[model samples]
Target: MLWLDLEGAVNVRDVGGIPTDDGEKITRGRLLRSDNLQNLSPADVTYLVDHVRLSTVVDLRSPAEVAAEGPAPLTRLGHITHVNHSLLPEHGFDATAEALLVRRKREEERFPGDPSCAHYLGYVEERPDSIVAALRAVNRSPGAALVHCAAGKDRTGVVVAFALTVAGARREDVIRDYAATGERLHLILDRLRSSPTYASSVDSVPEDHHRPRAETMEAFLEQVDKRHGGVLGVLGSNGFTDDELDALRRRLRT
Candidate 1:
């Protein structure tokens, strides 16, 4: 029942208190999800380090976004960034300027952004190797861990969805978990959409930042199913061993 709500941290929530399909509840405070900590206030930082005691932070943003976050402690920084292209849009202004958000596979196929759906599909076909490596690194922990991306929406969603599925959540339940991100994050997204950096991050007008449509989120989930054949299917196909999955189940589900 422990939850930490740091004022400056967006989308911060414990994955505990949620139940698995077998009627087991996910232990709270163990696995957490959050938006970037770039603007964390002193109080927010203090609360994370002292109150919630998050000793590990698995940052899934790219190196550039990592730089933007100022400095990361060497000890707690997990190298699990960019593990999946499952639910994320194309990165930043590149996605918006060229309207390539949904054409992520092409971008991945090219090792850069592109608009063709085929190339994007090709790219997704080759992502399993890197993703497995990323996951292995960040899954270790003795304290609370926060996994995040810049916006904590797409990439973060995929991982969270995967975890939920492994913990025995149904696809719909996994998706429901992903969609919960918007609950307290509207204000933060609004602020970012209006910030000076907004112009550089997106091509759309700040006014259009209204809210993420349910359809939009649904599309990402659909991609996961269509592309990966389902979360566990994708995980197994991607080289996640049975033992590793067992570890995840043990560590993540209570």
Candidate 2:
């Protein structure tokens, strides 16, 4: 969506620098999106941590995935503070059919506002506080922070979209960012499967469960637009202000 196709790594890059409908660029490095870092090679992690100055990590996977995958590696790093905003319930998305069967309209209702989107409405409603939480955490550290879900799509995408929208990225631009995950996901899925954590998972997430596919994002994209009239409506509905959002975008982008 936002990120043009780049090689070398998946789920890496700033959500800023991408131009919005209003013609402003989102800048770069303020918002890094990706699949879980649990599978990153030491070298990749080192590069991101050292160069990007990774300061905080947001894990958006379900609790079942976390217990199965274990804590993300970055959490244990020197001074990084790890936060989990588990979006899906224990056996959710992995079994989309069942999720839909049980929560059909639930998923539909959460967008544009919280306590609705079947999987993550609650978090969206409460995330301005999380944004402030991240700001406080970064205040205690030095560099960048990363936001992720199992496949770096969906839950993580919504949060990334939320942050960018608040930061002044246009609504369409935010949708583009959410769409970019599909391209990035291909690069990392195989490596993630090799991790010891997956082997021990009782609630083993299937291959399809990870990675943000274009179709899935599209579904939410349409929903968000229809439900909230794009970024302004949904976020405004959530209580983030124009001035406060600008402050966040400026600080993160620069």
Candidate 3:
């Protein structure tokens, strides 16, 4: 896990240098995952544009979240390609936060184990097209692709996990990358709490709700294997062609 050390986002990291099954590593700076980019400082902008050379922004945030937050600093810039792929159905974006929470509670009740994992499975079942679109956006990026949602743990994690798995990354390496976000939970939660759009959504929530657990990601991958067959199976069923999948692997792996 290569931390980017950005001033605005606390959970930003390059999903690179992880050893794959066949001994190659995912290329650094090709794929990045992070929290929101709405508060990027001027220096942060310079670092991302000049040093990171980020060319694509795969925003996994809902339409409501984007509308509520308005344009991020990078979105204001003309150079970067912005792709919107909300992992929820179209009507889902219209739901109120209370409604969203109720839906989450219902998912937890239905799944009966890890609430986070259950919600992730919902993401798979509900709007797989958006997830596939996000992956294709990453594959199409001319330079580093920064994939993000509000907190960048759940949505980003699920998408990145798919990409890494498709690229033949080891399961342990995938779980390690997902678990790395727990190290910055406080900073991530604080950033979210500072935002008017997310502060209320997180207030009074349990600590476990905010933190990423390895077990959650472990279970998610297992479900991906059992339920969807695998990354290739999931993406293929969602209309990702063999060429695009190959392009994705080539873009991320060395």
Candidate 4:
């Protein structure tokens, strides 16, 4: 994965050129991942739409977040298809202190060893439909598909990991890509702290806690393998078809 510098977003990157197990590489301009695009400047939009040929946006934020933040700049573009597939549960919309506490408790219960890993696992266990649908949107995109959430670390990380795994990318590379976010955790948190929709959640946590660790993703993928067989196993059990999986591999790899 390679980072893309943009004026409006800090964590935007192209998930291309990743090597697969069979010595193939993921094609550039086919997939991207990013933080929220609410503040995207006109130039950033032009670069993504014209230069990157971005065609689809798989937003993994709750309905309340989308509504709270209002329409993103890309939504104004007539040609781009925007799909919202929130990985959070229905009650995730409530951003209250109590709600956040309860959510964290639930995450700990899912995997007491690592709540972060369990949170990642919850994307598949609790919201498999959204996970499968998001993958389908990526596969069906005519050009590039950009998947994103608020900080582009958890929800975006999980989805991008699944995409790369399904496309046969090496396991270490997947974890590396997820951990890459740690390099920009400061910038990501700054952006989140500036937005009302996310400030409370971000401000309440320590800076170190916001960092994405390699072990978190490593454990998440290990559990996916242990419980669901693998990334493909989770998708297959969630109604993703074999033909669709093949198409996804073809779409991302060269």
Candidate 3 residues 1-254, lDDT tens each?
69988888899999889999999999999999999999999999999999999999999988988999998889888989999999976657578788878887888874677888888888898889998999989988988999999888999999999999888899999999998999999888889899888887687788667789898899888888899887788899999999998888888985
Candidate 2: where is the Cα deviation over 4 Å?
1-9, 89-100, 104-142, 188-222, 225-243
TM match of model 4 to true structure: 0.97
> Candidate 1 lDDT, tens digit per residue, 172-198?
556567667666556557546554544
Task: Please report, as a residue range, the 10-residue window in candidate 4 with the lowest summed lDDT.
Answer: 91-100
Error of 2 at 226 (Å): 5.0
Regions of candidate 4 where Cα sits further than 4 Å from its true position: 95-100
Residue pair clashes in candidate 1? 105-120, 106-119, 106-120
How many residue pairs collide in each prediction?
3, 15, 0, 0
**lDDT of model 2, residue 228:** 54
Local accuracy by lDDT, each model = 0.59, 0.58, 0.89, 0.92
lDDT of 4 at 211: 88
Give the Cα-based TM-score of candidate 1 against the true structure.
Answer: 0.73
Q: Distance from true position, residue 117, model 1, in Å?
A: 12
Off by over 4 Å in 1: 1-3, 72-126, 194-199, 202-223
TM-score of each: 0.73, 0.68, 0.95, 0.97
Pick the lDDT winner: 4
